[model samples]
Target chain A: MTTREIILARLRAALAPAPAPVEAPREYRRDAPVDLDRLVDRLTDYRAHVHRVAEPAVADTVAAILPAGATVVVPPALPPAWLPATVTARSDDDLDHTTIAAADGVITAAAVAIADTGTVILDGSPDQGRRVLSLLPDLHICVIRTAQVVANVPQALSRLTPHRPLTWISGPSATSDIELNRVEGVHGPRTLHLILLP
Target chain B: MSRTFLGMPTTAPKGVGHLRGAEPFPAAARRALSDAQLRRNLGHATATIRAKSGAVVAEVPDWEQLRAAGSAIKADAMARLPELLEQLEQRVTDAGGVVHWAADANEANAIVVDLVRATGSDRVIKVKSMVTQEIGLNEALEAAGIAPVETDLAELIVQLGEDRPSHILVPAIHRNRAEIREIFLRAMPGVDPGLTDEPAVLAAAARRFLRQTFLSTPVAVSGANFAVAETGTLAVVESEGNGRMCLTLPRTLITVMGVEKVVPTWRDLEVFLQLLPRASTGERMNPYTSMWTGVSPGDGPQEFHLVLLDNGRSAVLADEVGRQALHCIRCSACLNVCPVYERTGGHAYGSVYPGPIGAVLSPQLTGVADNASLPYASSLCGACYDACPVKINIPELLVHLRDQAPHPRGESAAMAAAAYAMDHPALYAAAQRATRLSRLTGRRGRGLPPPLSGWTADRDLPEPPAQTFRQWWASR
Candidate 1:
């Protein structure tokens, strides 16, 4: 046998046999009753923003965190929030470096979302604008739907195809190694707010 | 041979002082068995890094493509490394910079200490370079009466704390704000009397402390993120401006980088530019990416010394399957995602390099003969491989190293027996049948013999089923 074949044979013997083929690798499960407070704390540790968005609850959350007439970013395909129509959002259209950097924040919907790892997938297209907008912004308010969330990375990957561009977000951007020291806001958002819907 | 990676003192005893009777990884892990503080620190730090990396990485549309590009670029760099090194040597020589080649860590250290001593400087400011750490540069410098002051904020914390780094990206990740405050209060030469653990407060204190070193220090040391063969440029990326200070301000700058750190051209940087920043700090772009080509006139440092240290990298490079490790961007994304690193922290690994990348990379560099137990330091979880942007199959490499490495004593022979048993069908079947007795005791199975007892010490081996799967298959 060739070297590749020999190696593959050894690897095949090493690994447990592949499980009987399943129709789909995706295994959807209902959200278990996670302690919201614990979830918030855990997500916050990762620089995630947590706010309840049950109709009346969301507007209050947004208003509480952001001041009036504050520039908030939203995708063209975003769910409507009660912000005044006049409060202009920088859409993901004609998004050059200059325009994106100038904006206060840019929000986008997730692709294959993971709840176990608490990640949201954003594939940079029109809505996700080059991945720089969400990263550079001082504050990012991510919109996550219940159905969008999967249990684990495997499930998330199964839902995602290789064709589309995909970005998986779990928490805020931070670094700790300058002193074995943890420093957030090195290159990404110092603040991360996640909008969760039931 | 040049010992470029292992920076030990000539004055020190030739033999390794401790770890003679040190049990394998599992036995050493017993010391940390009750250390809750270490666990808490590691767990919190790794989880946080993972979350942040997940967040920004999710926003990118072409992240996979970018990863592929990064992997391809690194692969390209590795495949033609010898040619590139020769090219880089010619280029660096053509430029004003002096290039030194060392085959191992000892040669690298001797060359550097001699050069620094020749310059008659007792102190040198340092940029946070893993190569220097791997070579034990600080300790080596201290032995030679040269103080290598770390200028990076995080690096400053680790240096002052007199502590080893835990996470690659966040070396002092074990330190909380309150702990940092305590470290500063004790170590800083003229630390603020009443310092809080506030990140900004700590940062200000470090900045104040290092500002003098940055301005006055005549000699500087650093490791490169990428070395360009085309222009002989050394690239370093950092969040704080300290790395910039180390790279510039000083009259004499010495960069000790691994042979693997070289990239072929300037444009190849585009792939790593995206791959490294996001994978490391979880950023779109590193805050400060400073690149210097040889020595510039009337610009930064005039005298540039590039020490190309082989250490044991040639052995690693020789292995076709294992050479992919050289492709590491040093992003530390793997460590963030690794459960083992999250529990043990970097210190338990007993090396400058830690975590999954460190587990493979350090042993490869330092020679597994010296630190034989390190390869098994991890649980072979593929979390690191999944997280690696360049797709380094780190777990596979770890197992491969453990198999190939000679034991410091006769420990490797024991593993050989285990490997034999696993590879042999009858032995595996017999072992499975022997394990069948534990079925009677269920999950609380005990009395499994010496090495088997080691397995039961930490975890209950899965009780054999009423019928072995083989039995069922045979009957069917």
Candidate 2:
């Protein structure tokens, strides 16, 4: 028999007297009323800058965080209205590593925003671009609609697609590797800016 | 060098799947305790992690429910492990990923070495994985002339310093800033001589050194935090971007996973994802959690292979009461909160897994007799039980494992004699009278010589009292 068959045989023998699998008792909180205020507070606690802006003023929030003439990379599906006209914008569809690394920051939309943990889930959807676009650059400016915010983890998981590559970002790239002391800004974006639109 | 089909040793004559350690727990712990610097380093590190986990765990009001869900989910997975694995293999194969099964570490390492060799690359980038460490994959690769570069910051510290991991989460928890700086200067080529002990400086130096390797390395090896049997999705949860880089940039990816890591569904991840980050690194969510299902056309690692390793998990699962140890998520929460672990650190455990979980796990994964001293390592204060995220009854399991360990013939004989004496009331009273006679020889509640002195080495024995309680009651 192949090693796989042997292992399966062993497992079957071991599990003979064990009970069958049952539904997990998920009596924990599954949903919350999408609270943008709580989301902003939690995001802020993770050291990500929380910018609450009117839908029309989205470009201004992006402009405020970046220097003049700053080169920004945006996912191909990113709404053009979100990027300020003053800065040079490059679409991330056909960008190379060195080119993306050279950009000042990345701007994209999140598939869902988890309010409880202050996490933003990106599913490589059209607007979110590929995982590399958000990862290689030094700064990330993520936009989440108020409607995308979910109260808790189970609620957030229900909305996400399992097959798509997922990057769940809570804060800027951080590390507690040094004596377990948390210091932000390691490899991903050093600065994470979350814009919540009502 | 390997185990037979029956899980007996092929190279080593006696113990199979046992870690190579000469000193027992007490001997190693004594040495670890005397090292003042190591003690301070471990003390500060565990204390900080403990406080952070406590704060985050308290925030979730339904944390207890979440723990129960996590436990039940794992129990269900173990119950249906065979079917789940078959489903996993089929799903991964359908998703364009290959799955290989290895009965022990030797087979797993050989498979990984051959995979890297097939890539025509002698070097591979590694993400921090306990299973790979458990199997001694690095040593196997090195023997095959393949160089594996560790990318996680703590792992980099351990690798550069030519050291073994002392803590599960923070492998270099025994080393502080000054020591890390020294290791970097001595080992890291072309590093700045003027580098300071500041964490940011050290971290940046590591980033600069590893970035070139991440970009250049064609093949990467990782351990999966969770592999969903239903969808064949694999998750790698990490604090640093090193994991992300390895998962994405590499052309070929090989993931070594213990069979017990399988979750029945992707949604089962919600409980663990919440429990893990909070329990480890005390974060509401870690900086990055990367999940992928097999191979994607243009995204991350064109070639994917999952090596399902069952080095000794089958043995662990065979024991009815002891199987609960498989529920460990490798969050290191129990390690951080364990009072014994805080003082002794990971090195004393003499296994890749250390702390309260390791003490219970290592002995069972190997034969209990091979790691006989481990069950006695704990004070049984039940601190590990309270801190465990999955609510593994670690204390009860420790006692169960102790029963499996081979006791000294003399000790068993003494125990039998004591039991016999206690069963007879007249003899029990006579034995009490005999114990009271020690008061005459053992002056000042101490100084009982020879066999009795072992008990009073660090503590004074309570005076037996001149009269037995029964005699005093009779007089009253």
Candidate 3:
């Protein structure tokens, strides 16, 4: 028999005497009230820059996070109204390593945001682009609407589709692997700027 | 040597590094205990991690509920492992990814080596994976003349220092910053001579050294944190972005995951995502979590391979009482909180796994007789059970494994004789009076004689009462 057959057969025999599968009790606190202030607090606690802005000031907030003449990569479906005129914004339609890496930062809208953990989930939606567009850049400027913010992980997960690629960004890249001491910024975007649209 | 993969009597795998070691845990732990440097490093690192884990875990009011959910989800998945794996394989295959199965380490290594060879890349970048360590993948790749570059900072430190990973999450926890600086200067080609002992500086040095490799390496090998059977997505949760780089940049991605890592659905991640970060790194969320459902048209790896490794997982699954060891999420929470692990460190455990989880898991995977000493490595303090994210009752499992382990003939005979004597009143009284005779040999504050001296080396045995408890009861 093939190794696959052997392994499957082995699993069958092993699980024969095993007890029937039981649905895990979901008694855990699945619902928590979402608060924009709490989200900002959590994000800032992880050293991520959180910018609270009005709908009209979203572009200005993005501009404020970047320097003049900086090249920003945006998803093809990003709203043109959210782009500041002063900075250079390019659509990541034909993303190559050079273009994505050369861009100063990526501006993408989040599919869902977990307020408790300060995490923004991007599911490669039209506006979110591919996972690479946001990962290769040195800075990731994630825009999340207040309405999209959920209180906890379960709430955020409930809102996401599993088939699409997802990237969950809590803060800027950090590592505690060195002597178990946390040092922020390793391989992914060194800087994470969250623009909260309230 | 040929052994059965349950029924198939295939050739024995060449490098199944996860098996039990030749050296016993006591002797190895004795060597580990005498190393002052290892003791200090482990002592400080575990203490820091333990405190941080406690603080973050406390922030979530329903942490226990989350742990229960995690455990139940794993149990459910394990109960229907074969069906979940079949579903996972089909989903992955439908999503334009290839799936392979390996009976043991040799077959897994051969598949991976062949994959890398087919890519025609002499070098491959690696994300930190415990499965790869367990399979001795790097050594296998090196033997095949392929250079595997470890991209994770701690892994890089270990690789450059020519040392094995002591800790699971933080592979280089045993190394101090100064030692790391010296290693980087000596081993990392073109590293700045002016590098300081600051963690930031060392991390930056690793980034500089590995950036080109990440960008250039065509093939990447990784271990999955979880594989969802529902949608066939694989998740890699990590603090540093090295995992992201390896998961994203490489053209060909091969994930070698144990069969037990399969979860029923992506929804189950809500429990694990919360449980793992708080337990492993004390973070509300790890900095980067990448999830992919096979190959995306324009994103991530264009070619993907998922190798399901059985090495010893099926053997472990066969035992009804022992199968819960598969519920481990590799969080290292138990290791940090374990009193025994804190003093002896990870090296003494011998296997790729160590500490409380290792005590139960190693024996189960390799058979209790092969790793007999591991089950006795614990002091049964039960700290590991409290700290375990999945609520694995490690102390109970340790005792269970100890029962399965082979005892020395003399020890077994002594236990049997005692059991026999205790069953009979006359024999019990005679045995008790025989033990009291030894008390007359030494006066108060004197050392014990030959065979009993080994016991007194650590603590003095209390003097026996003049009359046996049964005799005193009878007289009263």
Candidate 4:
């Protein structure tokens, strides 16, 4: 059989619908044109910022949140002003695992966020940086542009390919291993903070 | 590698599907529920990941649509896999990377062994790779008297403890920090004897332990998350730098990639890069995502080899009901959310491929006629189906297997008994009423009866509904 025919047959067998499609169409638990304001309001558990502002003030916002004496992991190619002077930060290339593990909070720019799912996208770009810095630190503060938010996975796919490397972040690295009881901050960051800069 | 490579043992056979998926999930689950410790670890891990995944996924206005696109793209690719693979091989070869087509597990292992031997290297540091694990590359090398050092921290701990991976993303998810410290003490050649269970301390211990391997190892073996046919580029995404070290420092790099990992173009990578980490480790981006095309002149590894193994994949494709299994990315997100996997752990799946993906993938790879036990490994509750990003109907496939497979006589007997009860409404009523009596034909208590004990063995059956729906309907 032709390869296309074989693939369709396999899918047909896997589905085995009597007439109409057995697999349900994609679902959304949220109302259409979902509440972005409400979503961003509650997205992060940590103290956060949800202001409608320009891209340039990211440094000031991050600076306000970072406490004194907190070590920050800045991606090697980050915009210098994205971070405040109060935080002692190292470049992504120079920082080791030890420095990341000891740091109080991590801050980085995001690739995109899906409002429907309350998720963020990270590619290995200077803007998004590497995965470890966001993961190892106890707290994470992410900066996002409103325009980057897409409505669905399909639209997002149109923007991506197997070009380089990409990473997707939802909330934080957590486990529910302790007695079916959830304990965050075991392996990855315990607290997640997101900033929506319009 | 600049240094010579070692070979696999002569006559080392690829165990292949000689063995079925011998999972101990049911038994392991029963024991894990009570161990408080294991449950605690899993519960905490899954809950945090779930919430995080849910949140980040929410940020995407079209997350579900994206999942659909991702699933559809993979489905579309699988139909044209052969052509894509040939295209991938041509591109890699044209770009100067040696492409080895391995027909089966043994052939893949032997080819890798010979490749390493050709390099004249006896020892190689390895990045955490599921393909090599599936092929038993380490064991094959060890039998040939080579030590393949695991550089990924979790993998190193697992190797040291001689333990199986419990979770896909966190291979050592079963062990607590205290247990990890113990493993380090017993396994490390000369690790800090008084290390604490603190994450910092453990990170330090692993860092010191791996530093030498990173600087000294001449060869590294890896698995690619995505192979871009357009650019002949192979990519490895990770939260730790060890994967980068393996991709670089080594003189020769060998990648074991499943034939299904190829994507048509580089631009298509955006969808997966966005989906993978959030699905696997709940990260926005992996710590290190290194991409290289074939062999480079003065940069990174001077020599490169890509071994594409079919193993049982072609066999899987031949079966109409099972071929969708190839769309899997091995992200382990399904494993994390699956109640079955939560309790049974990865080792219970009985193979390098674990979780729901493994359940479907293994049975198909090995064939339903052989690994029949795997399909029955689930409750068919459809949790796995819900968790799968590719929309693979794992539960439905499981039932299909059940129908196609010759059920063990025990299962057939059990199913027959169940069918009998359902067929005869009066008999079902009587049995349901009778089961409320806890006595095994001995006591006068209301609980569970003897004949139906197996169904309620690990679970508490609903105290036979106080009133049958039929009786209520009759009265009405």
Candidate 5:
């Protein structure tokens, strides 16, 4: 018999008189109001710069966060208005790793945000292009709409489509390997700027 | 090798994986305990993580409820594992991914090596995965003339030092900053002439060294933290963006996952995603978590292969009471909280999996006879049970395995004798009275003679009082 058949048969035989099914108790909090302040607190705790701005000022905020004349990679569908003329913006149009790595930063809109854990979810949506676009760059400038914020993981997960590739970012890359001391900024983007729009 | 002509084997062959240590736990633990430096590193690391994990866990008022839910989901998944795995395979295939099954470590390793060869990549970057370590995949790749680059910082440290991983969350928890700096300076190519012991500086050195490889590596191998059966989605939770660099940059991504890692649905992630980060690295969420269902065109890796590795997981699942060991999320919370682990460190347990979880898990995977000493490695303090986010009752599993473990004839006889004496009040009192003879040796016996000495070698045998407690009570 094939290894697959052998393994499945072994499993079946082992579970002969299969145990009774158990219903998971999901009594944990869910579907609660998104607390923006809590989200800000968590992001700040992780050393990510957070800026609360009016929807109209998002363009100005993105511009101010980037160094003048810096090159930034943006998703193909990112709103043209969000990219100020001050920075040279390049769309991720079949960008290679080297090209993505060469960019000074990356800007993208998030799919959802979790307040309790201070994480931003990016599905490979039109605005959040490819996962590599955010990964290779040194700085990641993520724009989160207030409507996109959720209370916790379950709520944020409900909003995500599983088939789309997803990347959840809680903070800039970090490691606690050395003496268990948390040192932020490893292979991932070292600088994270979160622009919260209402 | 003898040509065996015998009756059919009564049981399946025991695991030939990295489940057994070179020596028994007591001997290995003796060597580790003598390393004062290792003890200090373990003590400091465990204390720091315990504080951090406690603080974050306390933040959530519903942590207990979450733990309950996490435990139940895993139990439910195990009860219907065959169905979930089949579902996972079907979904992954439907999503344009290939799925392979391996019944043992050798099969799994051969499959991965061939897959890498098929891609014609002599070198493959890797994410830190316990299953790969358990299977010794790196060695297998090297034997096939392939070099596997470890991207995770701790794993890199362990690799460069030619060291075994001593902890789960931070594999190099035994390494302090100065030691890491020394390793980097000695082993890493193009390392700065003057490297500081600062954690950030060391991390930067790694980033600089690996950035080129991450950009160029054509193939990557990873282990899934969770694989959703319903959607065929695989999630890898990591701190550094190295996981993204691997899962995204590589053209052909191969993920080796134990069959037990499969969850019933995508939504089940909510429970684990919450429980894992707090229990591991004491974070609200790891910096990056990448979830991909098979392959996403024009996005991450276009070709994905999920290797479902049984490698004794089915054997572990076979035992009714012992099956709960499969529920572990590899958070290493139990390791951090275990007093015995804090003292002797991971090396003592002698398995890639070390600490309270490993004590029970290793024995069952390799069978009780092979890893007999590990079941007794714990103090049965119940700390691991309390710390487990999935609520694995490790202390209970330890006792259960101990029952199955082979005991020396002398030890068994001693226990049986003690049990018989306790059954008879007169004999018990006489036995207690006879213990007074031990006082003649000294304030303490120091060490027992012959067969009994093994038990007292690592532990202290308190001196018998001048009078028995029962005698004193009767006099009063």
Candidate 6:
């Protein structure tokens, strides 16, 4: 018999006196009022820069955040209007790792944002592009629409499609490995700028 | 055949993996307790995490309800593990991914080695995975002429120091900042000569050291924090961007997961995702969590292989009362809260899994006889049970395993004699009166003689009261 068969057999035999099925309790809060203040508070707690702006001002915000003469990588379907006029915007259609690494920053749209956790979820959507686009660059400028912001994780998960690849960024990369001290910026984008748009 | 005689044996097969420590828990704990430096590191780290975890857990009004839901979800998954695993395999295979089954660590290791060799990549970057550490996967890769690079900062420290991980969340919890700086200066290539012990500086040094490797490594090995059986989605929760670097940049991604890690549905993640971050690292949410289903074209790794590893997990599942240990999410909350763990540290437990959870789990995985001393390693403080996100009753499991552990003949005899004496009032009285003889030895009995000396070796033997309780009661 194959190892799979053997393992299955063992499991089946071991569970001969099968345990009774248990129903998981879903008593935890599933939804709450979306509090933008709470979201900003959480984002700020994680050391992420949060900017609340009008939808049309996204370009200006991006431009202000980036250094002068900076080149930013954006997903292929990212709104052209959102691209800063001051900085060079490169699409990630045929971007290589070296180029992505060398880029000053990355800009993308989030699929959903969790207010309570300060998390932005990307579903490999047209605007968010691939996972690597946000990972390789030192700076990540994620734009989240007010309509896409949810109160908690459950609401965010329900809004997301599981089959697509997902990256949940709570903050710029951080670690608590040294003496359990939280240090921000390791291997991932050191600077995370969240542009909340209405 | 008699019905009673036909019962099945549920214990795990012997000589399988790294579950057992070379010496018993007491001996190893003795060595660890002597290391004052280790004690200080563990004390400081655990205290800090406990405070952090406590504060975050307090922020949620429904934390208990969440814990209950998390526990039930895991129990439901385990009760129907076979079905969930089969469903997961079918879904993963349908999504342009390959799934392999390994009954033991050696088989799992061989499968990973061959897959790396087939990719023709001699170096594979790795995420910090407890399961991989449990199986000693890095050593297996090295034996096959493959170098495994650990990307997690704590794991990197452990690897460079050629040290065993002492804590789950922070592997190098035994080392402080100065020690980490020393390790980096000695081992890290191209490190700045003026590096300081500041955490940010050390982290930047690691980022600089691994940046080129992350960009170039063709293959990566990871362990899943949770795998959704329904959607074939795997989630890896990490702090640093290294997880993303390894998961995204590598051409071939291989994930080794314990079969028990499978959850019934994607929706079940809400409970765990909330409970885990609060209980671990005391954060509302960790910095990064990556979830992928099989492979994504023009996205992350196009080639994906999921290895479902048993390695005595089925054996752990066989025991009715003992199986709850499988419900652990590896949060390390129990370790941080455990007093015994704070004192002796993870090395004393002698398994990749340490602290209260390990005390119960290691014995069951390797069988009671192999890891007998581990069951007694705990003080049954019930702190781990309270701290567990999945509500695993670790103290209960410890007491249960202790019942199954072998006891020395002399101890058993002594217990039998005590029981008999207690059964007879006259004998009990005589025994109590005879205990007054111990007072002759002084206020504190220095040590007992012969077979009983083992008990008093590490513990204090107080002097017997001058008057027996029975005599005092009669006089009153």
Q: What ranges in model 3 sit over 4 Å off?
A: B1-15, B440-462, B474-476
TM-score of each: 0.66, 0.95, 0.96, 0.68, 0.96, 0.97
Best by DockQ: 6
Lowest summed lDDT across 10 adjacent residues in model 5 chain A is found at A8-17
Higher-ranked by lDDT: 1 or 2: 2
lDDT per prediction? 0.66, 0.87, 0.87, 0.66, 0.90, 0.90
| lDDT, candidate 1, A22-103, per-residue tens | 1211122323444344445546656566876764465566666676667766555565663434446766554544455456
lDDT of candidate 3 at residue B352, scale 0 to 100: 83
lDDT of 4 by residue, B110-208 (tens): 878887787788888888888788778898898787789987777887899998767666778877777888998898988878888766567667766
lDDT of 5 by residue, A1-198 (tens): 677877887777667678999999989999688789999999999999999998789889988888789999999999988888899999988987788899999999999999999999999889999999999889999998999999999998888999989999998999888888788989999999999999
Steric clash pairs (candidate 2)? none
| True-vs-predicted CA distance for residue A89, candidate 5, Å | 1.3
Number of the candidate with higher TM-score, 1 or 3:
3
Give the DockQ of candidate 1.
Answer: 0.04
Measured with C-alpha atoms, the lDDT of residue B86 in candidate 3 is 98
lDDT at B365, model 6: 74
lDDT of 2 by residue, B1-476 (tens): 33245533111123323354567898999999999999898888888888898999999999999999999999989888989999999999999999999988889889999999999999999999999988888988999999999999999999999998988888999999999999999999889999999998888888778777877889999999999998999999987788988898888999999999999998999899999999989988898999999888877789999999888788788887878899999999989988888888899998888988999888888778778989888889998989888999999999998888887675577789999999999999999989867756566546666555554664676767778888999899
- Give one digit per residue, the lDDT tens place, for model 3 in A1-198: 778988888787777776786799778888779987888998898899988888799898888888989999999999888889878999977777878888999999999999899899998888999888898888999888999999999998899888788899989988998778788888888899998887
Error of 2 at B180 (Å): 1.7
Among all candidates shown, the one with the greatest TM-score:
6
Identify the CAPRI category of the predicted complex in candidate 6: medium
Query: Sorted by lDDT, highest first, which candidate order results?
Result: 5, 6, 3, 2, 4, 1
Docking level for model 5: medium
Evaluated on chain B only, what are the TM-scores of all the candidate structures, in order? Answer: 0.87, 0.95, 0.94, 0.85, 0.94, 0.95
DockQ per candidate: 0.04, 0.60, 0.67, 0.08, 0.67, 0.68
lDDT of 5 by residue, B308-396 (tens): 98777777888899999999999999999999999999988888999999998888877788888999998899999999999999988
